[model samples]
Target: MLATALSASIAGVDGVPVRVEVDVAFGLPGLTIVGLAGSAVLEARERVRAAVRNSEFAVPDRRITVNLAPADLPKEGTGHDLAIGIAILVASGQLDGERLPGTALIGELALDGGLRPVPGILALVAAARAAGARSIIVPAGNAPEAAATNGVAVHAADSLRAVVRHLAGVEPLVEVGPPGPLRGEHQARLDAPDLASVVGQRVARRVLEIAVAGRHNLAMSGPPGVGKTLLARAVAGLLPRLEDDEADEVRRIHSVAGLGARPIGSMQRPFRAPHHTISTQALVGGGPRVRPGEASLAHRGALLLDETLQFRTDALDALRGPLDSGCVTIARVDGVRAIPARFMLVAAYNPCPCGWAGVDGHVCGCEDGARRRYQARLSGPMRDRLDLHVPLAPVVSGLRGRRESSAEVARRIGVAWELQRRRQGGANSALGADALDARLGFEPRLLALLERRGRQLGLSLRRLHRAARVARTIADLEGSSEVSRDHLDEALLHRPKDAAA
Candidate 1:
């Protein structure tokens, strides 16, 4: 007898449908799984067999062959355990195959028949819906996430017995409720470290605001304890919350990474701050199995590199590609997997080896050659990618003054973001050269000023265009329709090269 069950596999942040076909015949009493099954997947046969026996079902003595369709597609994870077990039951005539059609199943099976939650439930639900499946059976623990899908019915099953009973028409598993109507924008309530908490560096704060409004990358150079890290965290808080689509994408990436039960919808933008000692693979994402790195996890959010100069130069340089392309492609022996990484980069570093190169309070203990080499860790190409650079000066007693709260700053940022969205259908940072030309046709004087500055500063065509984009964002913040010379000039001051040199 032959039976088939439906399952799903995750690739990047999306899901791929996989058909599990089982054949039981009068031959050697053995089980075989085909279709490029990974080690974990190949190990599912024992899990399924033990689960069936533990569920008080007879393990048929006939030889069984399980084949995952689309044999070329590499299948990983134990998500197929339940589906394979169910297929075996049907092929053994213990359960009817009629109910299997138009249904997809996803769950890991324990030796005792319990249905364990698996990663990528959201992606699986998405795949099932796209595959036109009438219903999907998932572990009870994963029901909420799977039910988030609107058009499909989701059946929550607790164990193999429950699933078998439901499919056999004895007792149906409980149907999961449809997800609530698109909830209102998730408000970020976590009181982000307030900008007012920082003792000084007013110039740095203003530059950060511009960077947040424009989705521009920023670098902060200062001695330790001058609020560089605090300022970066505050800047993340100042940015507007993610929209519906952006939130969904962020949640999906988190889900795939197995970060526990995320809110069904959230507006809080992701802020990924990896330690300096992180591996190149961990930073860029590539192992025996390719998974999303820090860059991919920070998609549509902020990636803060604290102690930026201390990190591996190769790992730091790897970011240049994703920073420009908004996606990181991991080339594996099997194929290339592209993960979205459209995020604003924020890095903090000391001015020199001793971190006292320019600070007034501290002595310059490091020699010039050492200072040059230390600063050289951050390459020119990498520095050029940053749109804003602010040198954080040492905080003094007199420098401590009243500063704006995150709420007030966020409101201004939200207004600016809305204006950009209305004008260009996207954020200012994502605008292309043609879009800049069409939407932000600058004033004649401003254009001439930008041209002259480009020559004087020896800016590449890319850098010049990016500066104009930032200037446009500055104009948007002021509710101005046209980019002015003042905006252009301020934008130039924030360029990384202007400070790094």
Candidate 2:
């Protein structure tokens, strides 16, 4: 007898539909699984056998062959365990296979026949729905994730027996309702550090607002105690919760990365601050399984590198591609996959290896050659990608200027963002070169000044465009109808200084 069931596995943050076909013949008592199965999928044979026996069902004493189709696609993870088990039972004549059609089964079956939540449930369910599955059965614990997908009836099954009973029409599992809205946007939801608490680096605060408002990449260089870390962290408080479509996309990527239910902190925006020691693969997205790296994880959010210079040169260079394309396009032998990495990059580092190279009242400890080598780590191309580079200094004295709360700052950012969305349908930083001249309301004099100053400074077209975008954002913040000379000059001033500077 042969029985088939529907299932799906994660691939590049999305799900690949798979058909589980089990054949039970009256010859030998061996169980064989084929069709590009990974170690975990192959190991599912033992798990299925034990789970079937534990669920009070007879494992047919015959040759059992399981084939995951389309057989050409490689399959990984224990998510196939549940579907494989169900197909085996039906092939063995223990249950009817009629209910298998138009229904997808996804979960990892424990040896004791209980179902365990699987990662990438959102993408998996979405794949099932896209593949014409009317409904999907997932682990009870993953109901929230599975429910996040629309156009499908989600059934939460606890144990193998419960699934069997539901399919047998003896006991049916109740369908899960759709998940509630993701937490409210921005400051209302996140308990992040308040901007008002940050004593100084007022310049850093201003740069952060412009960076977040337009989703621009920013780099900050300064001495050790210049509040670089504090300002970068406060970016979380300043961020608005992701829009609905963006939140769903981000949640799917994080789910495939196995961080869907991480915490409420991510509800607002994912703030990924990778350490300096992170590997190139870990930073950008590639591994044994080619999973999403920190960049993709920070999609629709921010990726902060605290000790920017301390990161591996290769790892830092790897970011240049994603920075330009707004995603990480990884070419692997299996195939090429582009993971979403459109994010605001925030980098904080010292002016020199010793961090006091230019600070007052502190003698630099490192040799000039050593400092040169340290600064060289941040390659020129990478620096060119950073839209703003604000150099900071320590403020040892008491606060002099007024320190506005994050809410006050975020309100202004929100207004600017709304204006950008209405004008260009996105942040100013995302404006294309053609958009540089379209409807941004740039003054004729300001445009002439930008072109003349850019040529004088020998700025690349990329830099000029970035500067223009920043200028547009600055104008938006002030409710200006057009980009002025002051805005253009301020934007140019924010450009990263030369490595020698």
Candidate 3:
């Protein structure tokens, strides 16, 4: 006899429908799985056999052949265990195959017959719905994740026996209802230490707001304890909450990375602060399993590299393409996959090895060559990508004054962000050269000033475009219709000083 069941597997944060085909025929007692099964899928043979027997179902001692359809697609993971087992039971005449069509079975099976929740259940359910599945069977632990997706009937089964009973019409599993919007404790914000926590550095605070409001990359250099790190953390809350579409995109990436629960509930943007010792593959997403790295994990959010000078030069350089293109395409011998990496880069670093290259009172202990090499670690290309480069000074002693809070800055940022999205349909940093021209519409005097400055600074076309966008963002914050001289002047102040030097 033969039977076919619908199943699904994950592929680059999405799901692919898999047709689990099983055939039981006369021959020596053996089992084999074909259709380009990865090691995880092949190993499912023993797991399914044991789970069937342990669940009090008969395991036919005949030649059993299982094939995952779409032979060209590489099938990995243990999600197919339950589907293959159920297909065998139906093919062996123990269970009816009538209910198998238009229903996706997704889960791992333990030796004792319990169904194990698998990662990417949400993506699997979404794929099932896209494939016109009428219902889906998932592990009970994953019910909440599955329920979060719309337009799918999800049945949570605890064990293989329970699934069998449901399929045999003996009893029906309870259906999970649609999950409501994330609220309260479920929506944990990233540790955005309040902007007001930093006692001073008013210029740095304003620069941080502009960067966050426009989704621009920013870099800060200062001696130790000058509030660079604290200010970096404060930028988190300055960002508005993710929109519904953006939240869904971020949730999909986290789900594939096996980052559970928090992303689904929070709707807050991702904030990834990878250690400086991270490898190139780990930073940009590559390993045996091709999981999402820090960059992709920070999709639709911020990626903070505290102590930017401490990171490996190669790893820092690896971010250039994604910084410009808003996505990373990691090509390995196995296959090439592109992952979304549209994130604001917030980086902080010390001025020198001794932490006082140019501080007035503190004398630098490191030699000039050491200082040069330390600064050289961040290449010109990497430096150029950061739109705002603010050099901080240590706070003056005995001057106590209150600064604006994150809530206050966030309100202004929210308004500015809404203006940008409404006017240009994206953040200022995302505007291309033509888009910048169309949006800025500066007068001849402002245009002449930019052109003359571009020549004096020897700014690359890319940097010129960035300056125009930044100026436009400044105008938006001031509620101006066109880019003004004051806006251009303020934007110029934030550029890397070396651009003029």
Candidate 4:
């Protein structure tokens, strides 16, 4: 007898439908799974056999062959365990095969027949819905995420016995309702470290506001404890909350990573600060099996590199491609997969090896050559990519005066973001050169100022364009229709003079 069931496999963050075909024939008792199953998946035979026997079902003494269809595609994970078991039950004449069509099963099975939650339930349901599956069965723990998909019927089953009973019509499972939108009435609250907390770096805060409004990359150089890391964290809090569509995209990425609860729709943006010891592959996403790296994980969020000079030059350079394209593509022996990496890059570093280049109290201790080498760790090309560069000064007691809260700064940022969205249909940072020129009609005087500064600063063509874009964002924050001379001057101040040298 032959029976087929529906299942799903994950590739990157998307889902692929897999048909689990089982054939049971009279022969010596044995079982085998084919079709590019990974080691974990190939080991599911013992799990399925033990689960079936423990679920009060008979394990037929015959040759059992399980084949995951679309043999060309590699199947990873044990999500196919339940589907394989059900197919076997039907092939062995213990259950009706007629009820299996148009239904997808996704779950791992324990030896005692309990269903285990699997990752990427949201993507799995999406694939099933696209494939025209009438219904999907998932573990009870995963029902909420599965039901989050619209226009798809989801059934939550607790164990193999419950699933078998539902299939046999002894007691049909209840259809799960749509998951309620994330709870918490104050979900819009953004509790970021306020700019006022830093006391004296008024200029740095203003530049940060521009960066947040425009989604531009920023870098900060100062001695330790000068509020660079704090400023980066505050930027995360100041970013506009994820919209409904953006929230869904973030949830899908987290789901594929097997992370916990789906993110609540909060205006609080993500802040990812990976340690300097991270490998190049870990930053760019690569291995025997390609998985999402820090860049992808920071999608629609912020990627903060603290002690930026300490990171490997290769690892830091890996960000160049994704920074320009807003996505990372990993090509492996398996295939090519693209992952979204649209994120704001913020990096912090010290000015010298001793981190005391020109402080009031601290004297410079590092030699000129050592200082040059320390700065050389970040190549010119990489430095050019940073849109805003602000040198932070140490926080003094007098400078730590009362200032605005995160809520207040967030309100201003939100207002500026809405203006950009309405005028440009996206953040100012993502605007193309032509679109920027058309929308941000720069005054000839301001254009000449940029040209003169570009020549004097020795800015590359790319840097010149980026400077213009930054100036455009500054104008947007000021509620101006065109880039002005004042805006261009302010934008220039944010660029590191030493970097230009």
Candidate 5:
């Protein structure tokens, strides 16, 4: 006898449907699982057998052959344990259904028959729903996460016996609906660093708001004690909540990374600030298993690199592809995988090795060689990718008047985001050269000015395009329909020829 159950396998943050086929026959008592099963999947044979026996279910004393079709697809993780166990019971005549349709199973099994939550439950559920599964059974611990996906019925089971009882119609599992309000008690914006805390650096604050508005990459260079850290962190507060599709993309990525519901509260965008010591692989995502790295983890959100000068050259340069293509592409022996990495980059660095080269009161201690070495980690090409640059100075007095709160800046940012979405369907940074030339709402006069400035400044096409995007964002912030000359001039000021553009 043979039985089949639907399951899914995760691949580079996406999910692929897999069929769990179990065949029981009269032969020497043994269990086998084929079809490119990873070590974790292969280990499920012992787990499923133990879980079934411990659940007080009879295990047929026959050869059990389990195949996760299609045979060419590589399956990893222990998510298929429950499906394999249930299929075996059905194949051996211990259960009624031989073929389960419109239903999918996803869970790791414990030796005592209890179902355990598996990573990527959201991705798995979404995949099952897309594959036409009307309902999906996951571990109780994963119920809330799976239910967040919506559009599909989620049935959570605590143990193998519970699933068996439901399948047998002895007891049906209660359906879990979508969890209301992905946001937590306080909104994410309220919890992030408030812009009012930093007493000075108005220009840096303005640039940060523009960066958040257009999702442009920004770099702040100053001595250690300046408001660089505070200004950089304010991006989280200014950032708009993830749009529906954006949230879905973010959830799927984090879930695939096994982050669970952590760092996803209030349905806020991710803010990943990896340490400077992180390696190239850890920064860009690469290893034997090829999991998503920090860049991908910050998908549709922000990736902040504090002390950017101390980071490894390889790590800093590795971001060039993602900064250009909006995705991190890793080519392994198996195949090439492009992980989503559309993120706003917020980086803060010192002026020199001693962290005080240009400050008014502090004198530089490091040699010119050391300063050059410190700055060289961020290569010329890499530096060109940053859309806005701010050179901060130390605070001078008690307060520079009254600084606006993050909420106030966020209101303007919200308006700018709506303007861009309605006008261009995305942020200004996502615009292409063609879009910059024709699509962006730049004043007719500013177009020729931008081209002339590009020539005088020796700006590349990439830099010209970046300047146009920043100008458009500035215009959006001011509620101006057209990118005025002042907006372009300020945008060009942020992208100096000596630095970025």
Candidate 6:
């Protein structure tokens, strides 16, 4: 007898549909699985066999051959365990596989006949639904996440015995209902550090607000004691909660990353701050498994690299492409996959090796050559990609400025963001050259002033365009439709300085 069952696996952040085909013939007793199965998938045979026997199911002494079809697709993980077991039972005349045509079976099986939760269950359920699967049987532990996906009925099963009984018409499994609809826009639900906790450095606070409001990439240069890290953390909370579509996409990525067990609320946005010692592969996402790096994990949110100069030059440079294109394409031996990395970058660093090169009233101790070498870690192209560059001064003691709370600042930022989206359908930082010229063209005098300054700064076309975008954002923040000379001047002041400077 021959039988087939539906199963799914994760590829990159999405899911791949696989058909578990089982054949039980009148030959010597043996089991074989094929179809480019990975080590994890190959190991599922023992699990399924033990689970079936432990569940009190009779094992026939027949030749068994399992094929995962469309044989071209590679299969991995123990997610196929339950499906393979079901297919075997059906082929051995124990159950009717044809009865569950459009149903997907996805779970790991334990020796005790128990069903175990697997990673990427959400993505698998989504793929099952897309492949016309009306129902999905998953481990009870994964039912909550699986139930969040729409357009599919979820059956949460606990053990192999329970599943067999359910399929045998002895006891029906309870269906899990869909979760509540994701939170809508216009709701501020981020749990982040309060901006009012940061005292002094008024300039840094204002720049942080502009960065968050426009989704601009910002670089902060200052001594260790300044509020650069604090400002970067606060930006995460100032940004609005993830929209419905964005939250779903983010959840899919997290599911593939094995972070589904974490308490990630639907509306929360990601804030990834990798240590400086992280390897290039880890930063950009590539290893044996080819998981998402910090950049991809920070999709639709922020990636803050504190002590930016301390990071490996190659690791820091790896972010250039994703920063510009808003996505990371990783080419593996298997194939190429693109991961979404539309994130605001916030990089902070000291001025020199000694960390006092640009500090007021402080003499630098590092040699000129060492300072140059230390600052050179931030390559020119990388600097050009980061738009806003603000130099911070040490905080003045007992002179705390009248700081606005994060709520107050976020309100103003939300207004500016809404204006930008209404006017241009995106944040100001995302504006292209054509859009910049068409929507926020500068006045003649302002353009002339910017041109002269560009010559003095030896700014490349990319830099000039980035400055223009920042100026547009500044203008937007001020409720202005056109870029003014004041806005252009402020944008230039925020431009990144040379290493020696």
Task: State which candidate has the highest TM-score.
Answer: 2
What candidate 5 gets wrong by more than 4 Å, as runs, is 181-191, 262-266, 398-400, 437-439, 496-501
Model 6: per-residue lDDT, tens digit, 1-501? 999899998788789898899999999998899998999999987888899999989676899999998787778789999999988999999887655688899999999899999988888998888888998999999998888887888999999888878887889899998776644444443556788788787788878887888899999988878888888888777887665677887888878877782323455678889999999988888776667888988988889999999999999999999998988888878888788888999999998888898677999999989998999999988988988888888877637557688878878888888898788777888888766563465766776777788999899888888888888888888888889888888888888776767
Instruction: In model 5, state the lDDT of residue 478.
Output: 89
Clashing pairs in 2: 186-241
Deviation in Å, model 2, residue 361 alpha carbon:
0.8
Pairs that clash in candidate 3: none
lDDT of 4 by residue, 110-199 (tens): 999999999888888888778879889999989877777888789999999899999888999999998566533222324456666766
lDDT of 5 by residue, 1-501 (tens): 999999898877888888999999999999999999999999998999899999999788999999999898788899999999999888988888833688899999999999999888887888888988998999999998898876788999999999988988899999987866555322446557998898878788888888999999999998988889888887888787777778778888888888886323457888989999999998988776667899999888899999998899889999999999889888866678788999999989887888988678789999988887787778989878989898988877748578788888888888899999999899999998767654567655778999999999888888888999999999899898878889999998988334322
Error of 5 at 139 (Å): 0.5
Instruction: List lDDT for all candidates, in order.
Output: 0.85, 0.88, 0.85, 0.84, 0.86, 0.84
Q: Estimate, for each residue in 201-297, the C-alpha lDDT of model 1 and write its tens digit.
A: 7788888888999899999988988899998888667767677778778777777777633454544788889999987778867677677889988
Quote the positional error of residue 335 for candidate 1 in Å.
2.1
Ten contiguous residues with the weakest lDDT in model 2: 182-191
| lDDT for position 284 in model 1 | 69
Clashing residue pairs for model 6: none
lDDT of 5 at 320: 93
Query: Which portions of model 1 show Cα errors greater than 4 Å?
Result: 181-186, 189-191, 260-264, 397-401, 498-500
Please, what are the lDDT tens digits per residue for candidate 3 over residues 449-474? Answer: 88888999888877777888889888
Model 6 residue 424 CA deviation in Å: 2.3
Candidate 5: clashing pairs of residues: 183-266
Model 3: runs farther than 4 Å from truth? 182-190, 261-266, 438-441, 499-501
lDDT of 2 by residue, 1-501 (tens): 999999998778889999999999988799999998989999998999999999999999999999999887778899999999999989988999888899999999999999999888888898889999998999998887788787999999999999989999999999998756646445543546788888977677888898888888999889998889888888887877677777777888899998874332246778889999999999999887779999999998889999999999999999999888888998767778889998999999998888999788999999989999999999989988989989888886648777899999999998998899888888888888887763788756677788999999999988999999999999899998788888888899898766877
- For residue 169, what is the lDDT in candidate 5? 86
